[model samples]
Target: MLAAVGALIIVFPILLLLLNAFKSPVDYANSSPLDFPAALDFTGIQTFWETQNFPRALWNSIFISTMVAVIAVVVSVLNSFAIGIGRVRGRTWIVLAFLMANLVPQEMLFDPLFQLYDDLGLLSNPWSVILTFVVIQSAFGTYLLSSLLGTFPKEILEAAAVDGATRWRTLRSAIVPILRPTLSVLMVFFFIWTWNEFLLPLAFLNTSDSLTVPLLLEQLNGERQTDTTTLIAGTLISVIPTIIFFLLFQRTLTRGITAGAVK
Candidate 1:
C-alpha cells in the first residue's frame, strides 16, 4: 500500500505533463492542467516537430549517450573484474579513488575541460561529451560492479583456470557471460545519465549541429509565453525514446539490481 501510494505520488506529475501535452492551446490556458484533454489536439506536437526539428537533437543525444554508455560499461567491467574478482593489490585504494572522484561535481570539471578542449579544437565535438560521460559514469559503474563481481562463483573461475584458460580467455568465455544482465542494467543507467545530462552539453555544445534534446528543450521552455502547448509537447517527446529503452531493458535491469542487492 505504501509503495503503491509512493509510486502514484511520483508518477502523478509525469502523468499530468503527458495528459496536458495533448490539450489544445486554448484548453491549456483555460482549463486546469490536471484535467484530461477534452480532445487530443496534436497541432502543438506537430508544430513543435516542424519548428524544433527534433530529429537532430534526438540523434545527438542518442549517439553521445550510446557511445558513453557502451564505453563506460566495457571499461567498468574490466576494472571491476580486476579489482573485485582478481583481488589486485591496492584494489581498495582504487575503489576509494573512484568513489571520491564522484564527489567532485561536474560543474567544476567542465570549465577547465572546455578550455582544454578549446585549445585542442575539440570543443563542441561529440567525442568531448562522450569521453566526459564515459569517465564520469565509469567510476560509478566500476564501483557498483565491483561488489557484484565479488559475488562471482570462485569454483567456476578455478575450473576455468584448471583447464588452462588465460585471464582474457576466462573473462571472455566465462565471466562476461555471467555478468551480462548486470552489464545491461549498468548500460541502461549510463545511457539515461548521459542522455539526460545538461551542463556539459549546454556549456560546450554551441553549434545547432551539436545541440541535444535537453538544450533544445531548455530553449523551447524559456519561450513560455509562446505556444506553451508546443513546449509541453516537446518536453514529453524528449522522454519517449528513453521510456521505450527502459521498458525494453527493464527485465535485465531488475535482475541486475536485485542481484547486486542480495548478499
Candidate 2:
C-alpha cells in the first residue's frame, strides 16, 4: 500500500496533465487537483492537433530521438568494448573525463552549444538536434555500458580469439548478444530523454516546422492561453509516445538495471 501510494505520488503530475487535457480552463482552475474532468472536452485536442502542426512535430521528435538512440548505442558499445575488453591505455582517464562531463550541468553548456551550432549553420536542422542528443547521452551510455562490460567474462573473449575470431567479430557476435538487455534499457532511456528534451531544441531551433513536441506545447501555452484545455491536451499528446516506450521496455529495463547492479 505504501509503495502504491508512493508510485501514485510520483505519477501525480502526469495524472493531473491527463485530467487537465480534458478540462476547460475554468474547470481546471475551479476544481480540486484530484477531481475528474467535468466532461470529455476533446475540442482542445482537435485544436491542438490542427493549430500546433502536431503531426509534423511528432515526426520530427520521432526521427531525432531514433537517430540519437541508434548513434548513442553504437558509439557507447564501441567505446565500452575498447575500455573494458581491449585494455586500452588511458581508459581510466577517458572514463573519468566522461564522468566529469556528465557532472557538468547541461544548462552551463547550452549557450556554447547554441553558439557552436549557429556558427555551423545547423540551427533548426533535425540532424543538429539529433547530434546534440547523441553527444549529451553518449557520456552516460559509455559509463553504463563500460561498467557492465567490466563484468563480462574476459576468458570467453580470449577463447574466441583462440578460435580465429577477430576482436571486432568477437565483440559483434559474442559480446553484443550478452549486452542486449543493457542495450535495450539504454535505447529506451535515450529515446525518452531525446524525445522529451526541451531546452536545447528551444534554444537552437527557431523555425516552427523544426519545433519538437515539447517546444510545440510551450508555444501552445504561450499563444493559446485562453484555451488551457487545448494546452493540456497538447501536453498529453506529447507524453503518449514516452509512456508507450516505457511500457514496452519496462521489464527489460528493470532486469538490466538489476543485472548491472549485481555485477
Candidate 3:
C-alpha cells in the first residue's frame, strides 16, 4: 500500500505535465486540469521551440552538464585517492571540510562568486557556471567516494605494491576498475543535477547567447501574461533529455546502488 502511494506521488505530476502539454488553451481555460482535453494541441510545443531558439539552450545545457560531470568525477577521484587510500594526514579533517562545503547554501555563495567572477572577467563565460558546479558537486562526490574508499581492501594495495606498481598505477589498474560502477552512478547524478541548476546559472548566464534550458524555461514563464500550457510544454521538453539519460544508465545505476549492499 505504501509502495503504491509512493509510486502515485512520483507519477502524478508527470501525468499532469503530459496532460497540460497537449491540452488546448481554450479547453484548459474552460475545463478542469483533471479533465481530458477535447482535442490535443501542438501550439505550446511549437511556440516554445521556435520562439525560444531551443537548440542553443539545449546545447548549452548539454555542454555544461557533461563537462561538470566528467571534470567533477575526475576531481573527486583524485581527492578521494589522497584522503581514503593515501592515508593522508588530517584525513578526517579534509573529509569534514568537504562535507561543510557541500552543506554551505548556494544562496550564500552567490554574491561572493558573482563578485569573484566579475573581477576575473569570467562572468560572461559559460565556464564560470561549469567550473562553479564542478567545485560544488565535487565536494559531495569526494565525500561519498572517500568514505567508500576508506573501506577498500588493504590486501589489494599490498599486492599491487609487491608487484612493483606505483601509486598512480595501483589507482589506475586496481582501484578505478573496482569503483567503475559507483563512478558511473555519480556521472549520471552530476549530469542531471547540473542540468537542473538554476540560481547560479541565472546569476552568471544572463545573456541570451549563453542561456541554459532552465534559464530559457524561466523566460517562458514570461514577464507579463503567462501561457500555462506553453510553460508546461517547455518543462516537458527540458526533462526529456534527462529522462532519456537516466534510462540509458539505469542498469549501471542499479548496479552501483546495490554494489556494497549484499556484502
Candidate 4:
C-alpha cells in the first residue's frame, strides 16, 4: 500500500499533464485543476508539432543520449573490470576518488568545461555534449559496476583461469554474461540522465540545431502564450520516451538494485 501510494504520488503529475495536453486551450484555462477534460483536443499536440520543430530536437536528443550511454557503459565496464577482475594496485583509492568526484555538484564543472570547450571549438557541437556527459556519468557508472563486480564469485574466474584460459578469454566467456542485467540497468540510467539533462546543454549549446528536447521544452514555455494546452502537450511529448524507457528496462533496473543490495 505504501509503495502504491508512492507510485500514485509520482504518477499523478504525469497523468494530469497528459489530460491537460488533450484539453482545448479555453478548457484548460477555464477548468478546475481537478476537473477532467470535456473532450480530447489534439489541437495542443498539432500546434506543438507545428511550432516546436520537435522532430529535430527529438533526433538530436536520441543521438546524444545513445552516444553518452554507449561511451559511459563501455568505459565503466573496462574500469570496473580492471579494479575488480584485474585486482589493480591501489584500486580502492581510485574507486574512492571516483566516488568523491561523483559527490561534487555537476554544475560546478560547467564553467571550466565551457571555457575548455570554447578553446577547443566544441561549443554548440553534439560531440561537446556527448563527451561532457561521458565524463560526468563515468564516475557513478564505474562505482555501480565495480560494486556489482565485487559480488561476483572469484572462484568461477579462478576455475576458468586454471583451465589455461587467458584473462581476456575468461572475461569474455565468464564475466560479461553475468553482468548483462546490471549493464542494462546502467544503460537505462545513463539514457535517462542524458536525455533529461538540461543545464549542461543549455550552458554549452548556443545553436538551435544542437538544442535537445529539454531545451526545446524550455523554449516552448516562451512560445506558448495563450495556448497553455500546447505547453502541456509539449511536456507530455517530452515525458513519453522516458516512461517508455523505464517500462522497457524496469525488470533489469529492479534486479540490478537488488543485486547491489545483496553485495
Question: Number of the top candidate by lDDT?
Answer: 3
Compared with the true structure, model 3 gives a TM-score of 0.88
- Residues 30-62, candidate 2: write the lDDT tens digits: 998578889876788888777778889889988
TM-score top scorer: 3
Candidate 2 global CA lDDT score:
0.83
Better of 2 and 4 by lDDT: 4
Q: On residues 1-263, what C-alpha lDDT tens digit does candidate 3 reach at each position?
A: 99999999998988888878888777788988888778988888887787788899999999999999999999999999999888799998988888876888889989999999999998857899999999988998898899889999999999999999999999999999999978988888788889999889999988887899889878877646657777888889987887797789888667756753565
Each candidate's lDDT (Cα)? 0.86, 0.83, 0.87, 0.84
Stretches off by above 4 angstroms in model 2 are 1-13, 16-20, 23-39, 224-226, 256-263
Between prediction 2 and prediction 3, which has the larger lDDT?
3
Per-prediction TM-score to the true structure, in the order listed: 0.86, 0.86, 0.88, 0.86
For candidate 1, lDDT tens digit of each residue in 1-263?
99999999998877977989988899898998878898989978998998886999889998999999999999898899899888899999999998875788878888899998899888888988888889889998899889877888999899999999999999999998988876878888788888888888888888877889899888788775658888788889987887798888877767766865786
In model 2, the clashing pairs are none
The 10 consecutive residues of candidate 3 with the worst lDDT sum are: 254-263
Give lDDT: candidate 1, residue 139: 92
lDDT of 2 at 21: 81
- How does residue 31 of candidate 3 score in lDDT? 83
Better structure of 1 and 3 per lDDT? 3
Residue 236 miss distance in model 3 (angstroms): 2.2
